[model samples]
Target: MFFSCKPAEMANLMEDEVFMAFTTYAAIVILKMMLMAPLTAYYRITRGSYANEEDVSRKSAEEKKKLLKAHPDVERARRCHQNDLENVIPFMLIGLLYALTGPELSAALLHFRLFAGCRIFHTISYITVLPQPSRGLSWILGMLVTFSMAYRVLSTVLLL
Candidate 1:
């Protein structure tokens, strides 16, 4: 009994506002990342671009060759999705540890919201072919937020 909290105490932990906020933002970013696959497919289908020969098997040989080439828009979508993989995975891992560290709810929410917002903006800027600094700034800001959360986790936890 000494090692375990009571059920009500466990419920309290589950209800923690910081953790709750983290979960909400985590799910939002994750869902957004997941949707990038379909978005990429949509871009490919609309643009007649396919990476694999098999994907254009139904077309004429010459058509297949043309379809297999990369389109600029498709490449943009693909790169945006790839960038999401890089940034979001780190946010999920570090955000979990950061949540467990019991940061102030407001501060945690700010971090989570900023990251999510920045990511969404990053995708829009990339896909819409916004000017250079738009996408670049969003990416850097989101990365900074993740780094901030990581710093909090490292500072709060006991070092090995």
Candidate 2:
């Protein structure tokens, strides 16, 4: 019975590790949101509203007629938020898997680091509007890391 519980305990530890990683990721996400808040505020101030997409599009058109320059910072903020939305799911999945199947601590750490690095690179590349290849590569790396964690979890389940 003790032996049987070992894996469960390890799995729990791994889950904790993953949770910590996710907490770090969440902090960065929050930072990104905070960074964008000012831009959003500016957009609202200049445009008289905070609605996005079709609403912003219509407002922007009307504002242009009135000779107000589009808020470039607000646009940047929108893009940053969009990028976060795109990558967050994969990060969460990987973290969850890590928690459930604590793989080698070093390997898991490496994967987490790589994923976080790639996310940062991806965001920078996006903000700078890097070449398609560079941005694509970063995104691919992030996905690969996430998939690796998932595979590890699935294999652990299979072994059980």
Candidate 3:
């Protein structure tokens, strides 16, 4: 007995890997969006404001001071959330590069998942009660993913 492979089948298999990577990226993005909800709620509840810039500016200095003084945890969460958003573009670029460069799709997918998980954990630790080490560890893990991806892309570009 012998086995035979078709050209169309091989092509389809190759396409699956890229599709899988894209789907994984999309899933992580959705999770990131979901994670923002709790952060937003905490901000709204403690800061008494939403994403409206005008509304935030309308608050008196006394009120702003009172909000910060009243809920330090919320302030911390807001700051952390903003930092996370700042890094999101780089993270997405890393994933996209990996997909484009035909790296180990599984590794890229795992990195994306790890980053998303670490971010959620970091947010929870920030918004709720948690030890410093635990929160710090989560933050570090998230940063590691971002940096690792950036390094991968840079190395690829430089080596060419």
Candidate 4:
């Protein structure tokens, strides 16, 4: 019996891509999961109904904001969480789509890294009250990643 190694092609799977896909998923999941910390802090600080009738009855977000007014840290945490949801959802979906096509290993790493690192740094900056442009730069990094992935997926390089 004999076996032969095949060249890199559509049928071939690169370890970098495969590992990045798995790690990207893990990192995304962790980022999402970590939001709970701020949420818990908000709930504790605000002392609002996190799981009780206040949640169901307070359909008006304005009401919730009013409740959290006394706790600026909590309010900031909530806003940061909202921002994360706004940006991360699209990025996560786009990242997953790109992962399936298995882009160039280096490109994949850069995109994944920028996307994850930007989000992480953005959250840190938001929580730490960093000056202007710090958060914006991180956001742009993540957006650039998504844009790059979108372009690659749409480009002639990979029809998938």
RMSD in order of candidates:
2.6, 5.8, 7.3, 7.1
Model 2 off-target regions past 4 Å?
1-22, 33-64, 67-76
Q: Give per-residue CA lDDT, model 4, range 62-158, as digits (tens).
A: 7666554345556566677777777777777666667666567777777777777788888778878899899989988878888887776566244
TM-score of each: 0.92, 0.63, 0.64, 0.66
Q: Which residue pairs collide, candidate 3?
A: none
Evaluate all candidate structures by whole-model CA lDDT and list the values in order.
Answer: 0.92, 0.66, 0.67, 0.66
Model 3 C-alpha lDDT per residue in residues 70-101, reported as the tens digit of each score: 35655676676686676566677666665555
**By TM-score, is 2 or 3 better?**
3
Candidates sorted by lDDT, descending order? 1, 3, 4, 2
Candidate 3 error regions (>4 Å): 1-19, 30-38, 41-43, 46-70
Candidate numbers, best TM-score first, in rank order = 1, 4, 3, 2
* Tens-digit lDDT track of model 1 for 59-91: 999898789899999999999999999999999
Steric clashes per prediction: 0, 2, 0, 0
Model 1 scores a C-alpha lDDT of 0.92
Candidate 1: Cα lDDT at 74: 95
Return the lDDT, model 4, position 91: 70
Better of 1 and 2 by TM-score: 1
Residue 117 error, candidate 4, Å: 0.7
The true-versus-predicted C-alpha distance at residue 91 of model 3, in Å, is: 0.5
lDDT, model 1, position 61: 91
